[model samples]
Target: SIPTSAGSESDAEQLQEEQHARSVLRETFLRCLLSISNKKVQFRMHEKVKVDATFGASDIDVLNFQVSDLHTPIGVQKEALIRCQDVISFTFDV
Candidate 1:
């Protein structure tokens, strides 16, 4: 039979590996955000609404994105914070 300590040790190792993976993913995402800063982006939101804006910055949690020169259906907004929940996707040119 396998020892209980052996199972616990493996569990701890797995947890550490998972944490490392998460850290890497978060770092990569943050880098992508940085690269997109100051670039023009097109956001596809709910109800098929789309808008163009200059990417500013994203909150640490990525819950919202700060933008500039937001061109909405109505008119242009000088600056805005777009909720991530409202956005289905966004794209920018490299």
Candidate 2:
């Protein structure tokens, strides 16, 4: 039979808390990325813009987003241009 000790229960609770913390951090990082993307889009609409936004856990993955805009006027008419790239890679251990 397994022993019902206070230490074991405490260990289990600690592990659960760690897992929850990791999950919350991951979610918050993702939300930050989304906000950065939106800001990049807004910047592109107005003028020629370039931005690099990077985020994420070291062991999991590193995300680098590059955004730019190129405007080409058509016969003296205003034009709009937008470009974005999301580059991701495994970086280092956490």
Candidate 3:
């Protein structure tokens, strides 16, 4: 049974690793969005503004996200709100 226990532990570790990777990918996406939104020039008005992101674990697990600017409005006061929403949505697979 020791070998079985070890296998279970390894599976847990792998899951943890995948979760961490996804978390990192989500964070990177949010940072990129913030940097882009902070640019001095205004984004094109009424543009579709689609953002696509993918996080994968080897060949099995994958998380894909596609968000439009219309769904997530970015502005001065809304920065934190937008980031929170994006992070939460990405983290929870929403």
Candidate 4:
């Protein structure tokens, strides 16, 4: 059954609240990323692989990360792009 406009005022208020919450969360996340920028970070990946890199920037969608001085088992890469899907976890000092 189609919902009438009778309850739309309440529905609109609820939607506005939800939008505000999402905006706040996104802003916080962006701030966190800013703090990590230009910092050394350790990444834990699948297959028990681990590496270190200087954080650069992440795409808006967070599909990948641009990093510098990536230290891998083979050697150090001057610059690289890491797929977020390949990363299990990452950490850095505040």
Candidate 5:
């Protein structure tokens, strides 16, 4: 049971609306990622790791990214799956 004290319920409704807006924004971001498929992108991760790879696709939950030709210190991997949690951000040319 929720207490309705001086417009508290309205405050809760406003919070719910804000959450829905955030969800829509997140879906839009995921769609943007999909639109950038097969493009060369640069990723920045922890430990100041920066590498380039061909963007394939990300899981529905944005957990992991399927990529190819992952450039690393040792060598470039022919195929790779980068964990999204490890990535700070990524960028590619429009």
Candidate 6:
């Protein structure tokens, strides 16, 4: 279904609210990452590929993951940065 535009003032207010909500969500996610730092976590990627690593940290923009001792099929990597976009999901023991 097609939607019509509201007044500029209303649109601006809505956009501001959306941005604020996104900011809050990002902050929460960062805090969660901090809690998981230095923990062993397994990332699940596409095609059912899974890799285990010692979680180090993440960039502010959540663009990449800093991990150590990454266990892949071919070999174990001493240190690597996993692209966040390639990860479908991940899990760790709390």
lDDT of 5 by residue, 1-94 (tens): 6656666778989989999999999989987987889999999999989999999998888899999999999999999999999999999987
The lDDT values for all models are 0.95, 0.41, 0.39, 0.96, 0.93, 0.94
Winner of 3 and 4 under lDDT: 4
Error of 3 at 86 (Å): 19
Better of 1 and 3 by TM-score: 1
Location of the lowest summed lDDT over 10 successive residues in candidate 3: 56-65
TM-scores of the candidates are 0.90, 0.39, 0.34, 0.88, 0.75, 0.78
Which 10 consecutive residues of model 1 have the lowest summed lDDT?
A: 1-10
Q: What TM-score number comes out for model 6?
A: 0.78
Better of 1 and 6 by TM-score: 1
Stretches of candidate 1 above 4 Å error? 1-7
Which residue pairs show backbone clashes in model 3? Answer: none
Candidate 3 regions exceeding 4 Å error are: 1-7, 38-94
Each candidate's clash count: 0, 0, 0, 0, 0, 0
Per-residue lDDT of 64 in model 1: 95
- Model 5, residue 91: distance off in Å is 1.3
The TM-score of candidate 3 is 0.34
| Candidate 4: Cα lDDT at 11 | 88
Q: Evaluated with TM-score, which candidate comes out highest?
A: 1
Alpha-carbon deviation at 51 in model 2, angstroms: 6.9
Clashes of 2: 0
- How much is 78 displaced in model 6, in angstroms? 1.5
Q: Which lDDT value does model 5 have at 27?
A: 85
Q: Arrange candidates by lDDT, highest first: which order?
A: 4, 1, 6, 5, 2, 3
Ten contiguous residues minimizing lDDT sum, candidate 2: 84-93
| Candidate 3 local lDDT, 17-66, one digit each (tens) | 99999999987867554444322222222344432223211111223222
Model 5 root-mean-square deviation: 3.2
Which 10 residues in a row give candidate 5 its minimum summed lDDT? 1-10
